[model samples]
Target: MKSKTKRLFLLLLSVIFVFNFNSIKGTAGKSVTKTVRVGYYQNEVFQEGASDKAVKSGYAYEYYRKLSEYTGWNYEYIYGDFVTVYNMLLNGDVDLVAGLAYTESRSHLISYPDKPQGTEQYSIVKHQGDDTITTNPTTLKGKSIGVLDSAIKVALENFLKEKNIAANVVTFSDYDALLEAFDKREVDTLAGESDGIYDRSHAETLYPFGETDYFICTSKDRPDLLKELNEAQSQLFLEYPDYISVLRNKYYPESLASRAFTSSEKEWLTSHESVAVGYLNNYLPYSDTTKDGKVTGLIKELVPYLFKQLGYETVAIEYVGFDTYDELVKAMDDEEIELAFPVGGGLFFSEEDGMFISKPVISTLTDLIYSTNYYDNSKQIFAVNESNKLQYYYIANHFPDATIEYYPSIDACLKAVLKGEATYTTLNGLRTASMLKKPDYEKLSFRQLGYADDMCFGVKIGNEGLLKLIDRGLSRAGTEYVNNLGSVYSDDMYKYTFKDVLRENFIGAFIVFLIILAILILLLLYSVRINRKRIREKEDAKREIEAVNQEKFVFLNKMNNYMREPINNIVSLIRISENMNDLTNIKNNLAKMGSFSKELTTILNNILNISSFESGQVKIDDSLSLYNFFGKRVLIVEDTLPNQTITSDIMKKAGMEVQIANDGLDAYEKVKAAPSGYFDAVLINVDDRNIQGYLFIKKIRDMENDIRSEVPVIAITADESESGKEKIIKSGMNGFITKPYDVKAILDKLSGIIL
Candidate 1:
């Protein structure tokens, strides 16, 4: 009886355990069972020009929402630095990263989806606080600049590679906030695009002088997933109706149904005579695709039609996606993206390459996709490209309550949404519609916001041949593209309906579009404008180097002329007259001589810069920022007092207040006791018995348990060498302040932390 009773209990327990396990799965329904790990640059902003103070948004937000919708997967968003994101991906701590620009350099490090809904443009935003002239990179020589990401850092460094300029770059993960700080004059210049576009896209204050493009990128670890995305995207673009609508919504929403054209519109189509065009990817929306899944979009529809009208046969088109722009650029440095359309000129060159501008294409606007259950939450979450700054600011303005997460690329961002990773995501409109038509989109819906810029095709840096044609073609056929879009959609949705408008005067619009396409032949009429040879231009391609060498040559000539004077003076004083020299007087002469030589060297450098600037061929260092520091108080601690009082008075005159220090211990004690260590900084002289300046900084670092201890330090000394500087820096000083320094250097160092 006891054995039978025990067997019954055991069976009951087994049944209970299974029931609980199955119960959990039943609740999930179609949702993914596993937890998805997502990583973002927590500092990245969702809206353009907005900061962390704002909400989550941009292309990243829409893409992820779509992902969650499709997969029913739940995700944990991990926010941190680049290393943190990348390391997590490697460790399986993160299953995905989205909204990153796809490039060859990044592909080597991670996997990527084959589809790219669209490309991105970067801008250099300047603040109204500082002197706007200083906003020009060319004017900034020795200054501080703020930047985000290693890629941008490298681009800045490469830009100023040969220039003799000094830039102290401050990095941040969220570029939008950084720009806001810049507008507030916090960082000298924000080096990313968010602020840049806000300034440029508007008319009131911000000015964008330069721009670059970013892409949707990801790791290449999962081929199967990438293949799915690749196929799905291709199909998304091929849908004719969506492609036409995207153009309408992006560039001509007011004329969404209007087929009307001005006289200039008639001349736009005849422009693309004999062209070369390239496609960034083979994904949907940007290219044409079929039911089986292929690449097709507004670009694809327009490329062939435009090419045929350009009076060209068999236009050579290349399929070089996000990853290949660089390699192809190396092949076409003065060469083009080998693609033709009315797009921005700078697209052909990566942001690092810095090129020109093109006409215009339909704006590629991204939308925020959300799960059905998401809006019910009091606070929405936004996803965006971690590297995109402008998207952050715009998002913040609209969704005030959202928290943001950064995804590496657009595909992964939407994937996060389809998998239910977040409450919101920003996505391309055409893509959202096409994806919705799919079986997966049943769980997703697109929240129609405003529109993005007119998306365009790309060409080489200096190629006006194709650009002129595109502008003319676009000018003429643009109305038709708009009209056609109207015809493609239902009357209710299409509003103006291209068929009705075009039918009224369709032949006239087409004829005008064709006329402009024919007139593009004049861009090549080069007889009036001869290629002028510039002696300066030929040598100025590498400006700094030639200038420095020229200075060296001038120095050698001076040395040759003055070589005998010092020796003769010495000999004459020693051999003949008592009046010729007093030992003390001789020492004074030598000191004065050394001082003059140093001044001369400094003056020469200043002269070289003036020369570079005058040439009009000199490129500015992208990394530099012009700053001003005056009337600031900095702590000075040394084992000795100022005997000369010369350095102190000079520092005071240069707009700085100096705190005196009689000993190392006194300086340390004084700095520590100050309210919150209220001093701007500590400048320690390294001439003590045991407590030298270098060691003093190290000790302070060790004492720092809170934010106060993280204060900046500078070792004021005469030792400036590779190893010596390294040792000094490692000792925990923010940097070095050379001894016998001029008032300028002192003021410059203090400017960074204060201003």
Candidate 2:
């Protein structure tokens, strides 16, 4: 018994110590009372259908009553007008005050819950039959306006003064006193709380104005308690959603009540007030960009709605590159963007958002396209939008084993396939269909890759409130305004080029294929016909035709020979003229003789060649025979600065095209630049300076080379140098000139050199 007692005593001591330790840690049995002091006007609306009949059913009492039940704590109502509540909270006398507006000054006195439970609008109460002030609030300027002696009334007066509407503010004892004055027409526009106005609407005589929300005010000393109250208020909101629903309806009277947010969204709103979004620019046609570079399209219209409904005023849209669109979504695993519009991109690769797509998108239309050429290929690799995995699954179910590579934008996907880099790409059906109006329309044809789906801006899973807000705003903006922006950017984005639309379109392809087939058949037939015709022609009229051609060649050769000798001889004659006398003495006489000879020759050659060719006897054989050298001294002439360039190129191709002359004077310079006895050849155009080739050659021989100033120099010219040989040879040249020359005779005389 003694041992058992000792053991029991020790065990009891351990249990007691553990219990006391837990109590010291504020855990085991401690109940912390998070006091939320509810302070508002001791009015009927606040006390609601309830514990006190004096207070009517309104936000203050109804909200606090629900909050008390939610947090298992009672709110001690500090009933008063503005001063009693403000002073009580300011002096650390209470924890929270209701029916308050957020203010810059008030922000320092309290820590707000980051999001408004809702917004507050106002009503302007005035005396009945007061037509003057009802027209504009400006009539109140410098006029006495009765205000309840409250902080809100002070703020209202200050707001009116800042707007340049001055008012003589009179402090009334309570809302009842303010109402009584308004009935007497003693003040201008009377300011009333929206809730107060809403509450007073029940009374028969006094008129209530407009409607708005009233906020709960909290004290600086009890911030933790304020947070507890806020959390309790949140639970109250979940339990009695009608409280927020009524407020929502008052603000958006035309809007329908939306389903409340799940617990997750409610939790998110308590933490953050802004959202981050994303856009991918490359997906054209379906989704494209604007000039100032903001996103606009079916999806863009949805983002503003998402933000407003979630109570976020600011949005940061990340214009992420297409390659990184899905990567940004992976950040949602880390909550990088609370909500994003994976945007007007493909729907085959990134659809995790679809798993949670509680919101409805307006439309979805898609098409599949492939290379127009190489018809047998159906194994296609497609560029899918990797960000929307649900969308990816949605597409893959139809085309299993269809290799889908993730692409950031639809534009990138289309370009990849159009450029023959990828085998296939899918674009929106409406986007693809309307693109046919663009010039590039014929370049591709796409039936529905499948069907269209409604497109909405996506939110990372937890942002349900914002997603719903987007739906609301979109419904407000309507589809017509939404589709108009789509048309403009689409016209700008998927604008097709001439080649893009026309090249390899149906008609061109058929023509090209038929032409290839026809050519192949013609080649086979021509091969059989070629030999028989060749054999017969060789044995018969081939020789006769050859003879006729040979004769024509000889006849032209004779004509060239007849003219060559005299021009050469005349040039020789002129070379020795300097020996007899000065050129100044002989210039005019020589010029006359030379000019007369040239005129006679032009008339003759033109008559001969032009008549024969017109008579159809002359036919040119393009057959060229290669030879090693030509010995004739060829003189080449020009009236302007001539170049070694033509000479060098011809030398490489056929050994020195001809000698170059800069001007008639420079022709003489070229002769001067050559070595003594250097020129064995000469070919000259009549345009060679204004100086005559006759004069040039005469100068060449007179200048004296060791090869005998008399070496045969042949003149080639468009000009006809047609003097008789005796006089010409007697004067100085070896030749006249040939125009429209034969390649063979020119070579004959040139290579006729013996030594």
Candidate 3:
């Protein structure tokens, strides 16, 4: 009986243990969604619209949403000013806060994850046009800098102390106030975090410094939450390694320089006394070798500029020119050329001829150049440069049935099209513009192919250190600098003088002059004989002839001025296109040429109305209203809803995309968000009740982004006084229109300015 009882007791204990184990497992399997309080403030991309419950969207906000997928955490956001929200997290009123850069002082009050979200760089900013100060710290020694009363102020103070530079640091309550003080000229400069959310459109970063990692912080009391958050973040990132980068790209279109050359890269640079770069000699406007063996192209200018950014001068570089890309590649393999320049980013380099590509220097769209007699061919034949695998593959994939003929270079490919040996050839659209300047290529018409290529520098595979240094230099130089370089080179190429026009047109103008002179001499001889026939009648007739002669001279002078003005403009454009070698500018000049041709036609039409000279003078009617604004986009800034509708309707009727902004502030934001050339024109309501339209336009004009900053603007107002008109012009507006939108007037003004 005793043995049976002991066995029963053991079985009971085992049953209880198994039941307990199953219950614990069930509890662990079920996910318990935890509610965490998150605190934030109104900072641009990091945390925007945080104060509003309806619209909470930003990088940090997106991060939390993504994190919830892993942690099953529900968040309740608490918003306040930056300091208030930070205090809330410290006091445990909120469990979490994001966008805090890790600092030793703050670490005591908060616990952070093992990995940071991203980085922020504090920088000094100035008016975009200000060149008084540079990246050199010495230039800022005595300048008064405006800074926010936040981490940015801390960074500025630290930077000042580190550089041993004494400058007055004025603090403001917030970013808006800080920028306001900067605009008022209360400070010589401004310092703030350099990020996408910052309004860089009107401000330029003088120099970036104090780069540090920012993290999502948890209250010290919530150590458990911190651990859970850390594990979830780790697993999340492990699954999608590019999660952070994807968020950044989605929220921030502009990138900041965050790279410094390592010791090895610097060593590589020092060891190389001179670097030889090979380029195709026929790639005009990009890189080309002159008859005298002098390199004169954008790539030639760019290489020196990039090197200068890395503290080296142009003397350290040598350019080697090749007629064919194959030759350039051969030079690279033989170590005769250390680098190949202006290489297409999509280019393929085989393992045997290994090469590394640097960051893109510039990107341009492609163009299809074809003979005017393309229809004469029964089958489409594409002429491709033998070394351009990108073009060859692109044509093969897009036109499977088409035949591709290989050529030695872009020049040869184009010539094939001109000779009718091929139906078409593709080249960089910008480069193609320079080619068309040749009179023979004029027989070939071209259009954009909706394709683009990034031009980069190529280095041998073994010289990765050099490639990294080049990439660092490119990053430091920045996109804005590269774009400016492109503009400068393009302008240089297209340069022309009044002397060129005079030389080209001298023969034609002289021939017309001789014909007019002969006609005048014959008329004088005929009048003299008529004068001698009658005496008193001769005197009256002579006086009458003199009056007619005076009228004729007046008419001729007026006609000459009107006709010659447009002719001079047309000739100037042609010469400029030849010199500039820029395709975009060529298109713009071509439009201008069309306008000039229309003006000439108007003058001719007026001449046909000779009967209008019955009043002893000729009257010319130069009014034209054949405006075709189809497919154009315009921004209409109007406060009143009805006015917005009316103006929008008018623009829409003309087949334009009419974007409306309720106020000047809204208009400024819209303009800031848009890409360059996105809007063909902007129409501002100058008498806006909220912000003055004149001030808004001035802000746009001061924008650092050249695309929208240089966009044409017209003001809408009730005031039609001469002073009001003068004010609009002085405010940097292209033109103005009185209130109560006139469709014809709007179309005409836009056509003249944009079209």
Candidate 4:
């Protein structure tokens, strides 16, 4: 009896202990806060800054803050340069990193979530004044470019290589330095994120190369953390479908919401009760109406959301099932339908047809489809829809001998080709892809035959208001939405010819073989002409160096001669003045000295001006109008006594109302105190030490009054190089004049620019 009581007591103790342990474990799980460590670098719209204050306010920081709210996680921020932060994540020093773009190399080191956090486009940026650089990659040969030492550098290098362009690529440590180098003319072009460049008013995007998906990456070992982050992100997106757009607009407002509703447009929307929309019955992926009369597809989903956002609460969508697109147009003309979607091309509609078309919702490649075994040398029948005038014109012009057969629909055309009723059919690549999925169309193949067709929406004539509304809605519907819709239906249907296959797969090998053969031929040629070529090259280089040295020597000798005359005259005048006791004689000698000094200044100025013009540093502004601005009033800021007199005399002779300031400080005060338009232009000597030319100009540019701030300022400098001009222009100067002012040249420049 004692042993049984002892065993029962022990069993009860064990059961109670197990129950308490489980309860404690559950409580611990609930109380513990998971720490999420994030690594990031400074970017304009992404990380923003490395400082704790700025990092906390950045897009990535805000994103993580929202994520923490969803996941109940605490964040620890780690900041460094991009490469260093990337390394930290790789080494597991950080649990996750924000604003990382996925690459094949990066994929091996870290894991990205299934859905990207956002997208950014990469662009080639150039000075707004630059017009010589073409958008074509082939034109980039031998051009200099600035890029960050990150993924952008790799992308730029790859692009250059692919185009066979041997460009000079300069890499910077960060985006700020890269832009600085470009602004300073160290590099003619820059490659980076579009938002950074587009934000600058002085810079413009030449072309966009590609887009990258931004992700919050995790260390390879932290897959569970990555999964949790993704879940939190998905929840946020689900709860707020416009979260990404809102973030983008907050950071890059200039790139989004470019259009605003006018008062009239607002009034129209307020007065309207509902909008009538129409769609076809068989336009897959874009729009489709079911047999039961239910409408669906991308247009149906996008149009309603857009209308709602535009402040319309109700919409009436109708499906118009016609035997042919022509019949559908006839129905619209008769006012049976207000608007129709998935219209093929603009060529089908005209003012005469009483229809207005919106901009393209999507672009599709046109392809020619035929059976694999079918071939005929004689005149062949081309199957097409009569409503598709663009395709009809293309076929009739390209195949003059072929006969055309009109079909009611794309489906009928494809069937006609398959059943040998027509020799071939031309259809959109996207539609062909959707049709080829069926087993019956397995034998049909396609080849791209024409330019891309733009699919849009058509409205009845005189319905301009409805057209405008549709356009506004389409503009608000971002590129990602349209691209997603396009990707669902479009497929690669192009059948490569034998030549294309060879070029794509083995061109490198073929080029190598050709190079080897050429080398052998060159060797044979060299054996016969090597001696002559070597002697000629050496002699030519020797002659070239000699010519350059001789030219410099002649220029220096001429300059010395010019200076000697002025010095001799001044010395003679001084000696004469020393002997003269009469006041008139003394005044005469002083006048001669002044004349010599002026002549000497003119000689030096001419030399510098010639050099500047020859080096292409001084760009003449042909748009200046002397009668308008500069001819009326001008301010001259010069610290040097000699420069002040020379510039004032030149401007005065040019018929300008010249106002002189002894220094930058004096100029700033005078300009600030003056009324609007008191001075049409300003010419400041950048070499002045007091108040500093750049600082003074910046202050003037930041003035509260628009007219006073916008007064064109020209830089006067002795440094006649491109860098000098660039520095002046970047300091907010409208133009620059190299030292040694010519009255006629100065007047001409002012006249061209002042208007």
Candidate 5:
């Protein structure tokens, strides 16, 4: 009886122990779940609606939701107007407030992240054809400008004061009211964000100024959260450098669809019974596959329609759905699908893998999307797509300090960022833009990073024929299709119709038309005046030519005297040689005759050089180290005793080490045999009988040693005409010295070229 009782007691204790263990495990699971409190305002870019009970919608909201999934944190959103939300954050009722622009006043109350969620620039928007209205602050003086009663309005007032412009600023309670005032002509200009006011065909966006960084605000008590948030935000930006641009395009959809298919592509499409197209299973705006297996999205609706228009009456589009972009790429690579729509640039596809890509079906910007609290953080964890080399390289180059965490998909990376597990993620601008417009992702905010590469379709390497066909179809779609598609996806689909254009700009257009007509008449009168002036100038130029010709003739006569004396001397010497009986006497006479002949040749060569120089046939290779060369050594080549003495003296006086060569042949031999760079500059007299100056220069230029060939050469000549200068330059000589050398001028030219 005693043993039975002990067994029952022991069993009871064991059962109690098991129950406590199970209870503790359940409690611990609940404790692990964290609740994050978010303060939201009803702003279109931040929070879309005023619903307090429903899921918060906006860029910030959606971003945090994804973050919650990443971090295993639950978000409790508190909704209010801008002021209410801001106060809640300061009061610690909310952990953080979304989409707050950083200001000195705000900074004193709450701590901000290191990097902004995005940037906002103020734009002066005016109706199309309002040419009189300009972006200049001075021009805006005395004009009525409409602005919303937000931080931007304060910025505008400050700007006006700083610029000293006296403008009548009209304040509106909301962006819609501001735009309404602009539309009704109540205000001449509307100042707002570009994404809010930019229109391709209707409103002209101008004068972007007062760029303010938007951030998430957190109480001083939650510095840790702010620090974490900042790290994550910075990492996101590093990965997706153009996330902000994507946001702008998403809200605006400014890119037009203009690709048209070629005839061959259309023919190929018609021949094929069906085409297999891969699309994302859940990528919104770009592509989406439903539970019923129906594919629909911007790419889905437009791609099929584009095919139908390309002569394929019943071209069947067999849709293949993939959970991630990677899967889509794999499907294309495996030839399971001929093409994949709404894919990234060639960076995502490898050429080695044999992929043929089409032109972008939709083009948009890329952006950095992050929480506002972590605006300036750098040492943060970044979530990036593992396969995206573009993002990988960009991040590696720009954000070296940030830790990188790879995800299979962009969405997954973004989720990591949202959860605070990773600091930030980058994405295509249009994709971010589309996400912002949706209620699910309304809380996320982005800053324009840069223009993203256009999104295109990808095909397997072997599908070149089909790829061309798809590209051809894209080419046929044209700009209208793109504009229409943008309108469908954009926040405002209203385009400027002919009637609207006329109604808005009739007076402006009429004034412009009258001004243009007047300008044309003025231009015509100016042309007539210019033509009359040109005729008179031409007549005057002809008279000037006659005077110049007379002067040249006189100059030539003076030069002829130099030739005549040399020729006469040579003839006298030859006649003397004929009378000589002894061999020594005969040789002496021949030598004298040769000297005279050489003198004549030198005069003739000088004249020829002058003519060539004047004709603009000479090109000077001015690239020479004159100071280093001339300071060391200079070679003076001249057969004439008087000229040689003058040349050597001038070179010595200029601080150049002189090496005298009696004639051109001697100079050439010295230059050819000397070590490279031995001579700094060579002074040649082309009149030498053995080798002409031109031949010497040409030989030096063609030498095996580059240093010797490149040495500066200056011609010493009696010809003072422009033609003489031309000839020296044409012969590859750097410059010319007249019969009477000017020491200062020669030194100056040398100094100028060398130094």
Candidate 6:
């Protein structure tokens, strides 16, 4: 009995020891409640109000509360305006203050943490749909910029001075006042911190600058408190690597509200109580109506939501359905409907058609539906629906040679192809996806046309105010919701049964069987005619080979003659120019020599191009056009006189002042003597026997003047392979143009490098 009592006592002592150990481990590296006086200010979204309210809410508030888990510090909040609170921190009234932008002057009296709490960046924001202001800093000239009287204002002034932009800086007491001035159109733009502007979905960031770290600052005398704060911050980061991002996301999630309307738009909205919206009744999954007259589809569902977001009552929208696009458009034109639904396009409605369009809600691919029997038609014929003008126009413009058969609808168009009246039809792959699954279209297949059909709303012309409101609402609806709504309406994939396939392809299969049987019967008689046919074929083959060889011989002969004439003319011109005493005539002859040299180069390049084609080694694109380099100057370095003349003439034709340097030393000396930016670009011949191209470019790159060293240099070479191109780039040349380059090729290369 005594031994059992001792065991029970030991068990109780062990439980008590375990509890104490856990308590110690839980409080490891944490202090008891140390009341730290924190200076707080209303820095919207970051911190707000005084005492308990400031400590309970905001990004900084959350950060401090999270930090307290480690530091075990309870904040004694001292509330005041921004300046008063900051001065309190300096005067030692408060131990620390959050949201102080770090500066050299602030660092003298206060100590900031080694790592910043967060970065505060400022931007110039303008109202959404304001087209007068732009991202260009110069656009701010003579404009009034509203700024909260804080560090953001100072940053704006610095930005103006640095960019040499002269603008009126209108200061307000707080962010609310600044935003009010902007909403009243008293200022063209407002400068605000990122956190302050994050929730204002109506404001567009015109220019972002003045990025600086905001720190939790403390007095220099309180090193011990600062150390504890810094250590706690480090511990918090170590525990949660994404703590800062989490706090920011929690506080500043993107707002779904649409931008407020302008005064004119508001007035227009007040006048119009309801809007008549029309849709194509047959365009499925995008726009359609039930037999009961209830409009239902992916985009139809989105329209009411858009109105709701735009602050318009959904009941005010009256939906009307039309069987055809033409009918819908007519209704819109006749004032029967104020807007049309689900107009598919890269452009929904053209201004030329007297209609305005809103932003697209969803986009789908365009595809060609063709018969499986004849993949390639001998005579191309496209079936287009009268309702789908986009498809008809695309077919007409892209395949002008193909014949088109008009139908009433996409269904009729596809049926015409099945009946063999038309070879194919183009359509939106998404809207007709359900029809494509049916047995009627099982024999048809889709080929992507590499075009997108962005479904959008359309309205009549002179209704831009309404259109603007629609666009604003659409923007607020967000892409995710629009895409998810589309997914919800997407039909499941239809699996075809064996019976369905057989029933659909019965007639075509039977016709194919007949053709196969006829071919088999014809095979029996083929042997009898084979011997005679082979004899004739042998003779024809011999004649064809002889004709091909003759053609080749003639082509080579013509090319040889063409090459000789240009060279002979160039030699004669050079000799004649040397003998001429008249300066004008000499210059004219030199120009003729340049032209002849260019012709000779073209012939040689053609020969190389032909060889490349036969070997399938290269294909030169000739679509590039010569870029204008008017008022620019260029230096041409070449040992060959003909090449120098050709390149110089090319540059001169491009309206550039050209200077010729025959040798590397002369070229180097001219560049060294010329002022910075004097020569726009330099063309160096890589095949120069005297000066190595790589070494010459290296010399230019190593010039004493920085601007001169970085002048655009283009290498001229015979090699066009990838390895050769890489080697040229590695040799310090900006870019390289191949030998025998035409005006387009040379100038395109020059413009890319120079510009």
TM-scores for candidates 1 onward, in order: 0.27, 0.29, 0.46, 0.34, 0.32, 0.39
CA-lDDT, candidates in order: 0.50, 0.53, 0.73, 0.70, 0.65, 0.73
Q: Give a tens-digit lDDT track for model 5, residues 618-672.
A: 4233442234434568888887544554456456645678888877767889998
Q: Sort all candidates by TM-score, best to worst.
A: 3, 6, 4, 5, 2, 1
Residue 114 lDDT, candidate 5, scale 0-100: 84
Candidate 5's C-alpha runs over 4 A off are 1-31, 52-57, 91-93, 172-177, 183-185, 197-201, 231-755
10 residues in a row with least lDDT, candidate 4: 496-505
Model 4 segments more than 4 A misplaced: 1-31, 53-55, 256-755
Q: How much is 615 displaced in model 3, in angstroms?
A: 15
Which ranges in model 3 have alpha carbons more than 4 Å from their true place?
1-87, 92-96, 99-243, 248-258, 313-315, 345-347, 350-353, 376-378, 385-402, 407-412, 437-443, 487-520, 524-546, 553-755
| Model 3 TM-score (2 dp) | 0.46
- Between candidates 1 and 6, the lDDT winner: 6
lDDT winner between candidates 1 and 5: 5
lDDT of 3: 0.73
Name the runs in model 6 displaced over 4 angstroms: 1-150, 153-196, 201-258, 344-349, 377-380, 393-402, 490-755
Clash totals for all models, in order? 108, 64, 5, 6, 57, 0
lDDT of 1: 0.50
Residue 166 local lDDT, model 3: 91
What tens-digit string does per-residue lDDT give for candidate 2 at 428-511?
A: 655665545554434665666446555546565555665555655565556666566566656555443323122214334434
